[model samples]
Target chain A: MSNPARAESIAQLERLVAALLAKGVVSEAELAAQQASTDRASPETGARMVARAWLDPEWRAMMLKNGTAAAEAMGVSMAGAPPLGVLEDTAKRHHVIVCTLCSCYPRAVLGYPPHWYKSFSYRSRVVREPRAVMAEWGSPVADDVELRVVDSTADYRWMVLPLRPAGTEGWTEDQLAALVTRDVLVGVALPKLPA
Target chain B: MNPRFSPGSRVLVKNDWPEERGPCHIRTPHYLRGRAGEVERVLGAFRNPEDLAFARPAETRVLYHVMFDQPGIFPADGKQPDKLLVEIFEHWLEAA
Candidate 1:
């Protein structure tokens, strides 16, 4: 079941795309290619970057300095995508991203924004009562830890580089990537060691 | 395009819109107007989205990573974090 307003909006978008295609402004092949590239990097792309950063200091530096470039270096196209800002979660600070106006996400790397991320409550309350909202996710940041809430209000989309969990000394990059779930990518939860 | 502010420079968001620019398809969020922040990074030049939204020739403008303190945005017994970053176009900023 879909809300009538949302269904109408989706229909309008489909019509617009169809018109663009009919006018040759966008070729069908081009449209398909762009759609494919839109999600070229799944959540695994973020995970791979984090895993590599954990293992390689230089790569970590690059990811911290310029997330878009770092993603491209990892063979992610990122063409026609907005600039990506990777917020590093550290011992002293934690990071969370929300677009108060709309769900502006780094889809090239993080795939699609989650459902709750686009909800009105999450968008509105996260900016005002981030701690309370975060607590609902069951990954509350300790009071001592400074929480940085990044609002992707413009063309810049943000993502979190979650801290590497302990007790995984000999874990391979693939294993580390496996630990990175959608929640971790969204900064609501942290990656954990396998039980 | 020459950017107004460089990375790491402090800047203030303009409280008011530019003269005679009718408000339609503006990208700068209302919450950030008149707010002060530091340019965390330079995002290079891009076609002005405000102009592009209206089907006009999109003049390029520099975009910056503007970082604001959470306390400054929301004060009084809140656990809202230390910083909030937003991407603002050069046109919306002035040297602090």
Candidate 2:
């Protein structure tokens, strides 16, 4: 059964869209095209980039230098989107991303953000107590590592380039990409070797 | 306009709370207001989002990547080796 409040919100949105369509402000084809583009986006695109970067030094350099160009080179359309910033995680430094003001994610690369990412609890707590928050998600950062919380509060959208897990040196690109889940790209979790 | 601050320059975020009628859109988070940090990079110029939100003719403003120590934002956290990075417009920042 659909929730009443959600159903009402959907109805309201539909009504608004219908009004816009009737006014010729937007066309059906345009809406369909937009939806198709959004549907084409997912975390797989980002995982592919990460897998390729891990295997190629030049690709990694380009990704670190310009994330938007890297994404476009990988066949992902970043037109009209804000510049994407790839935050590289290293041995001594770890990075986590948040948008305390709103849900400003790299939607073209990582798709829409998870529901929890948009919740008030996450937007408020992550910047304040990131370690405690990550621990709750079963990913803990050591005290020795410098944990940097990146706030995508303005124009630039951010995604994490997690350090490749050990023991996956000989793995194929497909295998390496499989290890990078959506949470890993967001920096809430790290990829690990299969148990 | 050219960027007013360069990378490695220490800057402070203004703590002003502008009052305006009707809908308002502010990109700077309240937690970062009044905090001091260093410019990590100059991210070029873009139209002022505050004006853009209202569909006004927005002026281009330089944006900066600012890095701050976590303990500086939260004093009770003690001297932890953690940091925070935020993208703040040049208008909201001043040389500290």
Candidate 3:
């Protein structure tokens, strides 16, 4: 059975869109084009960028310096999205991203955000107790290592360029890309060799 | 518009809330209000989200990357030595 509240919300949105369409505020074609663009992006795009960065030092430097340009170089369309900021994870420091206010993710590269990323608990708890939150994800940060929690509070969107794991030195980009997942890109988990 | 704050300079998030009452799109988080932090970078000018939310004629404002110590934000959390970076607009900041 359909949830009544959700159905009502959808109906309300449809009505609102219909009203806008009637007034020519937003055209149906424009909406379809936006959806198509959004559909074209996914975590694979980010994984490919990460894999390429791991293999090429210059590409890695560029990715660290300007994430949007790096993503564009990888053929990801940044079009109307906010500037992307790539946070590089090092041996002594780890970076995790959160939008304490809202789910402001790097949608141009990583596609849509997961449900957990928009949850109130994740938004509230992650900022106050990030180490604890990561531990819950089975990816605890070491006490000695510096943990930086990046809050995408305003215009900029962020993603983590996790350090490449060992034992994959001679791996091809495709093989390395397979190890990078959405959670890994978000810094909630680290990429590991297949068991 | 030029950026008011430079990288490495200290600034504080304004403790007061916007005069406008009721719900509004505010980028500055409540926890960061009144907190002191060092400017990490100048992110250039962007339209003020507060005005943009209402579809008003908005003016561009300089945004900044501010870094605050974890322990400083949460004093009771002890010496964790962690850091938190937030993207804050110029209007919400002042020289600390």
Candidate 3 lDDT, tens digit per residue, A86-142?
999999888889988878998889998998999888888777788888889988889
DockQ of each: 0.55, 0.74, 0.75
Q: What share of the true interface contacts does candidate 1 keep?
A: 0.60
TM-score-based ranking, best first?
A: 3, 2, 1
Candidate 3: which stretches are off by over 4 Å? A1-5
Residues A144-183 of candidate 2: C-alpha lDDT, one tens digit per residue: 9889999988899999999999899899999999999999
TM-score of each: 0.88, 0.93, 0.94
> What digit string (tens of lDDT, one per residue) describes model 1 on residues A1-195?
124568788999999999998888999898888888875658888888889998999999999889999989978887777887888989988888888877888888888777888999887777767787778887877888888777876777788998888888988999989998877877878787766
Alpha carbon lDDT at A153, candidate 3: 89
Residue A170 deviation, candidate 3, in Å?
0.8
Off by over 4 Å in 1: A1-11, B17-23
